[model samples]
Every structure is written in structure tokens, then in C-alpha cells.
Target chain A: MEIPYTISTRPDTGLWNAKIGIWLFLASEVMLFGGLFSAYIFLRIDAAPGTWPHGLLNVPVGTMNTAILIMSSVTVVLAWAALKMRRYRAYWWYMLVTILCGVIFLTVKLAYEWPQKFEHFGAYIKPEALWKYEKYLGNQRRAEKGLEPRIEITGHLHSENAKEYEVALDPVNAEPDSPAMDRPHFFPLPVTDKIATIEKEDVERATMFLPTHSAYFASYFTITGLHGLHVLGGVLVFTYMWLPVSKKLYQRNPEHLANRVEVSGLFWHFVDLIWIFVFPLFYLL
Target chain B: MSLKAFHIVFIIFSTLLALGTGAWCVWVDLVEGAPIYLAGAIASFAAAIVLIVYGVWFYRKMKRLRIIT
Candidate 1:
């Protein structure tokens, strides 16, 4: 049996069936994202001042991804408009650009941004050894430039697991290009400059910040990961729409193809819309 | 009123609500010295503004063409 309203508007709603269906799906999607956003708010509010991580994400990279997604949204709309005007070639070109943008956005996110977070480890130093560690970093910086070491404080690195080991206060190969080195002083030693072998009892806790490290990370992974999945889904759908099957449909009924593009375009817009919020909330202020 | 016109109006109203809520949250965050909700709120406001402008433009174009009358 032929489905009604696939190419024309229904009498009651005055919208094609798929258009109504997409809107309903998008409404549910909004609610899903809304609840997660609420959870993010709650976590941020409950976090203690100075405990919430800031300036951890690379802002420039995130801004690039945001621009990419926004541009893709434009292409999506153009693709749909081209289809409506019966410009099949233009429609395909726009759709291909949209898909490419999605692919690039995901690549930057997973390849560059996420790995930086994973490679970073944070160690909680004991109050007594904290000052010594600062001095060690200073000495190490001078030594790296061929200058004489100033002062060395040797101590055992204490991890949160209660494991203690006598280790040098020297910069280890653990973290290269550590962001913490630029800051005055902070927890989770970005790098160790020089080895100062000291007693094992002087250290506090050492921990690596994985996704399980803090509430902030947990929410970050959850929200961004979900968004990534959505991007992937959009790319796949657009690719399928660009396939010969859709072309055959277009030949049979151009309006049906146009409606398909419109429905997909609506979804693509929503994906971009979510990223607009995600970019600022995750990367910027 | 026509269903199409009603849909457009509903979207406009929703956009306005998003803009208002986003602005309010941002103001609160500024006063409170960086609340978690502020970032999302600001983003939502920005996105809402873009969407509102686009929607209004599309509405006008449709009206001019008698597509949504």
C-alpha cells in the first residue's frame, strides 16, 4: 500500500508526514539534551570554588570546530533549498560539503582535543613537599637552558593509593609540553624537572585525571561524546541520501527527494544548534 | 489561523523564551563570578538569536511568495 502524505501535506497538520515525524523526534532530542544540561548546571553549582577546573581545554581548537559546524549548517540549508529548486547537481555539492565538514569536526575533536586530556596526569602533592617541588621546577627550567641548578628538594612521590616511592624531583619524560609549567604553581605536576631522591614518607597523593577523575570530566565526556555520535549519524544519513537510491527516487518523484532533504536538513540544523551550546559550555566560559 | 502560520508563530515565541532565559542566566553568572549555568545559557542565547533571525527571514520570504499564507 502506498503511504499518504509522503510528497504532499496532510489535511489536518498541513505538513508532510516526515516533516511532522522529524519535528517530533527533534523535540525528544531537545529534552534529552536539556536534562544533561541541567545535570551540568547542578554539578557546577555544587562544586567547590577553586576546585572546578578552568582553562583546561584548548579554546582555539574548540572555536575552529564551532566554526566548522556552523558552516555545515549553512551547507545543509543550501542543499535542501537546491533540492526544492530542482537543482540536483547543486544539491549534491552542498550535501557533500556538509558531510565533509562533519567529518573534519569529528576528526579534530577525537584526534587532537581528547588525546591531550588523556595524556595529562595530575598528582596531589603533600603540603610540606609542595614548596620544594616549586623550587625544583625553577631549578630545572634554568638547567634546561644550560644554567646551574638553584636548589634541589628531594622527596618521595606520594600517590592517593597510599603507595610511596623515593623519586627524583627532576623533570621526567612523563608530560612534555605541560601547560602547568607556565602557571605560577598548581596541583597535578605537569612535569618533573629534576630528580631529588628523598624519603618516601614526604609525598601525599598522585593521581591521573581520567574521565573518572572528577565530576567535570564525567559531564564533559558524556555531553561531548553524545554530540559526536550525533555528528556521525548526520554524516551517515547525508551520505545515504547522496547515494543512487535517492537518485532513483528523485527520478520517480523529485518532491519525495526534496522532502527527504528537508527532513535531514532539519536534523542537521539541530545538531549544529546543540554544538553552539556545547562549545561555550565545554571549552569557553 | 492557518496551521503553517501558527507553527511559525510558535517557533518565534520559543526563540524569544530561549533568548530571555539565556540573558537572565548570563547576568546571574556575571554577578555570581562564573556559575556553571552561565556558559550554556550564553551559548543558548547566541544560537537562539541566530535561529530567530533566520526564522523571521524565512517567514517573510514565504509570506511574500504566498507559500505560508
Candidate 2:
């Protein structure tokens, strides 16, 4: 089930060399992300529902980045089309615009989004924070035990052959202010406060994965982190191509620069494509 | 449109489909914070399938015209 390879020795021109190289590069990138995503799927299944820590992300900000990347893809295609039309001036302007979009995307992610993550990471990794979390949980459990009022009943818990029942209390004998249902807001609600407080023991159990949360957070960071790196690399590539050196190269063989842009654009589009997969799996699921 | 232009349009449309759907996924997850219908996932998967089909179709068309090897 493989596509047959064809060779072309056409003056190192046409789309042959650059197209093949980009396709191969994309294939390797597929394996890199594929492995990470597969790990995410397995961990997701292994972990219980609502326990994967999916609530840590800021959705609105991520959505904006998505729009920016899509728009950049449009600009890149326009730039490539300008080249096909042999309109060098239009091609340069569009390419510069596309590169600018990439810069904005990376700046937003690193300067804004990444710092928050670092702050959260600092809180999670601190031994003091873990100690505080434990103390809070202990207090909640103690509160639960203390809060429940003791009551003396004429009829008590009765069991026969593994069957158990509590005798119905007479209204006259019953305590008017029973505290059986008193719930204390203890254990410092799951960092996000998105979900309700679970049992003290469950909180401790979940805390084992605390330092970094779950595989979901791991994948979230790894995928986006790698994508960010790609964006940076792309900016550098475009910068070099837009520089005087690239202009000199283009003056000699203009098609070389065009081919270079085509390859870079392909990689940029692939980065956008991976985000398509990452957004859903991380933010939605 | 010529084949080249058609190819460009297909790629852009498919990419937009992927991005819009991907953003929707992030929005839903942020709002709901749990899995539901996953409309964004559905959209991206559909876009990926279409992109692949279009890629193959474009490649074949180019080959037939001897524009590409």
C-alpha cells in the first residue's frame, strides 16, 4: 500500500525535488506525533473518566491561536500562487505577511500562554504545596467525623444473615439537628474548581499524579511545545529567505527561492494540521 | 480554474476546515470540560479524510497531464 516513487532529472527544476523532500519530512513528523498521541490514548483509557485533568486549559486563547494559524495558511497559499503567476513583488509581500502571522502566533503562545503554565508548574512542583494539600484534606476528613451528631436510638442497626437495616426512629426520640449530611469544603478543590470536591482519600489517590497531573497534561505540553518550536524554526527559515542573502540567491536562480518557499509552506501547513488533531484530543476530549 | 488553482483552493478549504473545527474543539472543552458530541473532532476528521482524497486526486490529475512525476 505504498505510493510508487518516480524520479525526475529535469534540471533540478519543477516541483520534484522540493515536493518529495517535503512529503518525506511530513512522514517523519507523522511518526513523531503519532507516538505521542498513541501514548495519550492508552493513558486516557487507563485513567478513569473526569479524572484525567482536562480542565486545566484556557479554551478561548487556544481558539484564537487556531484562527491565526488558519489565516496564516491562507496567506502562504496566496504567496505560492503569486509565484506561479510569476509576480515576484506580490509573492514577496504575501510571504512576508505569512511570516509575520507565524511570528504573532509564536509570540502569543510563548509570551502569554507559556508563562501561565510555568506558574502552574511551580505551584504543583513545590513540596510546600503538596504538604498544604495534605493538611487541608486531613482537616476535611476530621470535620466530616466531628460534624456528624451522635444520637441514641431505641432501635439500632440490626443484621440477620448478612442483611442489614437501620430501624426507623420514632419522631419523639430522634435528634432534631442531625448533622449526617454536613459537607465541609475541604481538601482544596481540584486546582481548577471545575469539578466538585471528592473524598479526602480520593484526593490523595489522585494527587499521586499531581506534580504534572495526567498523561493528558503531558500530551498537552508535549504537542504544543513541539509545535511552538516548529513555529520558531519556521520564522528563522522565512527570515533567511527574506534576507539579502536569499535575494542574492533568488537573483541567480529565482526558482530556487520559490521552491524553498514551497517546502517551508508545506511544513507550516502540516504544523497547522497537527494542531487540528491536538486541539480536540487535548481541549475537547 | 486551472488545475494548479484548483489544487490551491482545495488545500486552503481543507486547512480552514481543519482549523475551524480544531478551534471549536478547544472552545467546547473549555466550556464543558469533558467529552460530549465532539463536533470539532468530527469536523477535523472529516476534513482530514477530504484532504487526503483531494491530495490523491490532485496528484493523479497532475500526473495525467505530465505536470508532475
Candidate 3:
């Protein structure tokens, strides 16, 4: 049976069936991401003062991913335009580039960003015991002598029990609250390796910079992980359409293929829009 | 909506996002002490300019084909 309005607008809605359906799907997606974004804000405000992490994420890489997603949106539009003009080969190449953008974004997120976080570790130093580890931590207090202290040591760690942890410092001066970290890296500081073996009484908490590390990290992983999945989903859909569906459908009904591409393109644009907000929220502000 | 109309809307929305993100990047660079955000700011503004150019060209191209209103 023929699909009604597959290639034509519905009289009442002035949109094709798939277009309306995709909009409705996108509306639900708005709610989903909206809730997650709200949660991020709530968690961020609820964090202890000056304890929330900033600059822990690679700003340049995040920007690169944002640019990749934006580029993908452009390619998706170009592909749709190509389809409209009956330039099937142009459509094919544009769609492939769109898929590659999604792939590259996911690779940077998974292989580089997530892995770096997992390998890194941090722990809060017990305020009372701060002076005891002065040789290693150097008593560089993050608080302004009145506020609750926010001293965290970051490195690769090995912890066999809740009582103690052994950490070889990551070598990069990752002290977020330290004014020194603000300086751009020009040459490696000629400092010898420092390791800390802390007993439970002197340790407030310790963790790899995973989701469990803090509220900020938990929200970060959840939102970005979901967005990454959306990118992967778009890549799969576009790949399938490019290889099998578009080839067969164009020969039969190029108009239907165009509508399909436009529908997918609409979804692609929405994905890019969400990242525009997500990038500034998590990575910047 | 027609594909042509939606195309215009999409380009406009993307340009707005780039412009907004560019401003945000500037704020982040100045206030947040991250000089790297300047690069993000430059990229976003460039994207906004590119989108505007592309939108104008695409509109004219579509008009030439009598495909858009």
C-alpha cells in the first residue's frame, strides 16, 4: 500500500507525515534533555562552595567536537539539497562526510576524553591533617583562610582499602584552585616525582575522576553520554540510508527519498542545537 | 512546511546559535581565565558568518530554480 503524504504535505498540518512525526519526536527529546540540563544546574549550585570542578574538561577538544557537530549539520543540509536537485552522487558524498563527523566526535569523546578522566584520580585532603602532608601537598590551602578548605590532589591512584591510597601525581599541575594551573604550559616544570600514601584518618575521600567522583562529574557523564549516543544513532541511520535505502528508493521515487533525507536532516539539526547549549554549559560555564 | 522554507529556518537557527555561542565563548575567555576559549570564540563567529553567506547563496540558488517562495 502507498504511504500517504510520504512525499507531500498534509493539508491540515502543512507538513508531511514524517516531518510531523519527527517534530513530535524532537519535542519529546527537548523534554528529555531539558530535564537533564536542569539537573546539571541544580547539582552545580548544590555543590559545596569552591568545591565544584571547572577546567577539568579540555576546552579545545570540546570546541572541536562542537565544530564537528555543526559541520555535520551543514553536510546534512547539503545532502538534502543535493537530493532535491537530483544530484545523487553529491548527496552520497555529503552524507558520508556527515557520518564521518559523527564518528570523529564520538572518537574524541570516548577514546580521548573519557579515557583521560578514568585514568586520572583525585582526593580531598582532611583539613585537620593538612599540615601533616606538607612535604607532599605543601599546605597550599585553597580556602581564603576562612571558608571551608577545598584541597584536592589529582594523579593516578591505587587503593586497596578505604583506609589508604597510593598515588603517583599525574605530573601535569592539575590543581584547579591553584593560581599556578592558570598559566599555559610552555615547558615541563623540573620537579621530581611525588607520591602520596595517605591513611584513612587523613583522607576525606578519593576517587578516579569518574561519574562517582562528584555530582558535577555524574551529570557530565550522563548528559554527554546520551548526546554521544544520539550522534551514533544518526551515523547509523545516515549510513543505512546512504548505502541501501537511498540507492533503491531514488530509482523508484526520488521524491520519497528526498523527504526521508529532509526528515533525517531535521533530526540532525536538533542534535546540533542541543550541543550548542551543552558545550557552553558543561565545558565553559 | 516545504523543504525550502525549512531550509531557511534551519540556516537562521544555526546562525543564531553560532552567534550566541561566540559571545559565550568571549565571556568565558575573559572571565573564566581560559585563553583557549578565544579560539572557540573565533570559530563560532566564523561559523555564523559562513552560515549567513551560505544562507544568502542558497536562497538565491533556490529562487533561480523557482523552488522557493
Candidate 4:
């Protein structure tokens, strides 16, 4: 059950086995995320003018998550530093904070963000829908602002029937005549703002912003969902390393334990780096 | 790569992200006139500068460390 090179570097490679293995794993991860990122770029490029969604995510929330991940990265590095200095208690506290950061990030995403998206509804009406649903939209105001006619209304479903659906719209956004909507972006509006009804036949598409909603939602859910899983993985790994059993291992082989922490730290840093790219791509730009 | 080198790369990457996102938020703010984007821009640039200082401190401290059993 003994493994060589866990602590000491290999003569030929000048590195431990775990370091090389983790690099290989991380290389594959890069390609995986790279492919999806490329797809997103193409999708954005291919979208029709003004048809592509923007500003649909909560920028402040997204930025906060970025900060949390960055802080976690710092704590994880500090944890490794403590281990190197033989400060086991300090390492434990730093690792605990790192784990808590990961937990908080996931909690905000699942408990607050995604649920906020789920209960809300959005629909892109059929082209002819304007004829009948004119009063439900603020397109007249949109036109004065030199924007495209309003084809989408995002809010909560007021009611639905065999023939029609009643809904509230213009929710959590600028007032009907407010200048904010004049901007060249779409911000997230996930709430029951104002109410209106629509004939079911008038809608061409509807969604709760799930992955199946549109290209934007699909990319949003898939990429963020995968990233969430990674955060969860980091939490689990750090938790294991912080447990009492790991302390026993550290006491018996301090160098080996330090090397193990280093390896984990490298992976955790990789996770943080990915989020750096993710934040701007998904939230800001 | 050594773990130290990897950590350096992470810090460097984080710096770049902060700078790039800051520039982007500025652009978005110009177009949308939203105060939140303005706030984002300021925060990002601050984070970038802080990371630069932190990276240097980390480098100096880590360079001499050697794990002893």
C-alpha cells in the first residue's frame, strides 16, 4: 500500500507523481471548458441582432460569487503555507474557511439564484402577437428608444387556461417609460412585477430560464451547473483533508502530508482560475 | 509544474481577470448608464492591484519554505 514519490520528487521528472497526474487531469479540464467556451462565442456571433440575450444574469450576485471564489483561493494557498511552516492549527483554520467559502458560493447559486429563476416565466411571442397583445407590452415605448419591438415579456405567470395564459410583465425592470430599458443589454428580471393576460396561441415560446429555454439559458445552466459541481468537489476534498484521520496521517508523515496538501491546493487554484474566466464571460460581457 | 509555480500562475491569472473584467464593466456602464457596472469596475481594478501586491508577498514567503517531517 506504500507509494513512492508522494513527498519527494522523482529523479527524472523533478516532481512528485501526484503533481504530474493532476496536471494531466487539469489539461483535460482545460480542453473541456475550452470547447464549451468556443461554442458560446460562436453562438453569440451567430445570434441575430438584438435577439441575443444580455444582462439576463444578476451582475451584482455574479460579482459577489467571483469575490468569494477568489477569497477561497487565497485561503487555500494560505493553508498550504501553514502546512509548510508546520503550523497545523493554522492550516486547519485556513482550510476550514476555504471550505466554507465553497459552501457559501453553492448556497447562493442554488438556494437564491436558481430558485429565483425557476418560479419566474418568460415568453417570446409570435410575430403576429403584437396585434392582439399590444396593451400587455411596452413596445411603443421601446420603439421611441430606438430599440427593437418588444417580443419577449419576462415575469410570473398569473394564470393559464385551455385557451389563454394570464401573466404579469415588465417585472423588476425600468418603468414602462423609464430610460433604463433603452440600454443595449438585458438584465435579469425574475419576479412578479405587473400583471397582464395573453391568449395561449399568441406565444411562440416560453420558459422558466431552464437550460432548454434558449441558447443563452442553455449555456448559462450548463456552464454554471458544471462549475457548481466543481465547487462541490472542492468542498468535499477539503473537508476530508481537514478531518481527524488526515491529522493522524500528518503526524506520522509530515512531509508526505504537506505534499498531499500541495497537490490539493493546486487543484483548488485551478478551480478558482476557471471562475475568473467564467465571471466575465457569463455575467459582465 | 511545481506547486509554487502553479500558485503563481493562479495569482497571475486572477490579476488578468480582474483587469479585464474591470475594463468590461466600464464599457458596459458607458452603454447602459448603470451605477452597478460602475461599482463593478472600481471593485475589479482594486482587486487587481491587491492581487499584484499579494502575489509578490506570496512569492517571497514561499521561495524559502521546505517541508520538514
Write out the backbone clash pairs for model 4: A55-A186, A55-A187
| Model 1: per-residue Cα lDDT over A139-232, one tens digit each | 4454475643322222234332343444434232222224333322211234454444333455453334456756788899899999999999
Candidates, DockQ: 0.07, 0.11, 0.38, 0.65
In the predicted model 3, the residue pairs found to clash are: none
Cα error of candidate 4 at position A18, Å: 0.9
**True lDDT of residue A91, candidate 1:** 88
lDDT (Cα, tens digit) per residue for candidate 2, span A199-235? 2222222212223645666677787889889888887
Descending-DockQ candidate ranking: 4, 3, 2, 1
Best by lDDT: 4
Report residue B29 deviation for candidate 3 (angstroms). Answer: 5.9
Output the number of the DockQ-best candidate: 4
| Alpha-carbon local distance difference test for all models | 0.67, 0.57, 0.78, 0.80
Assess candidate 4 and give its TM-score to the true structure.
0.91
Error of 2 at A134 (Å): 13
CAPRI tier for the interface of model 3: acceptable
> Candidate 2, which segments miss by more than 4 Å at Cα?
A1-15, A121-211, B1-69
How does the DockQ of candidate 1 come out?
Answer: 0.07
Kindly list the per-residue Cα lDDT of model 4 for residues A1-285, writing each as its tens digit.
Answer: 889888788999988899899889999999998998899899999987667777777777887888898889889888888887889999999999999999999999999988877877777789877756655556777777677666777777778889876676654232445565555453464454567777678789887778777898888888888889988988999999999988998899877778888778888888888888888887767
Candidate 2, fnat value?
0.00
* CAPRI verdict (incorrect, acceptable, medium, high) for model 4: medium
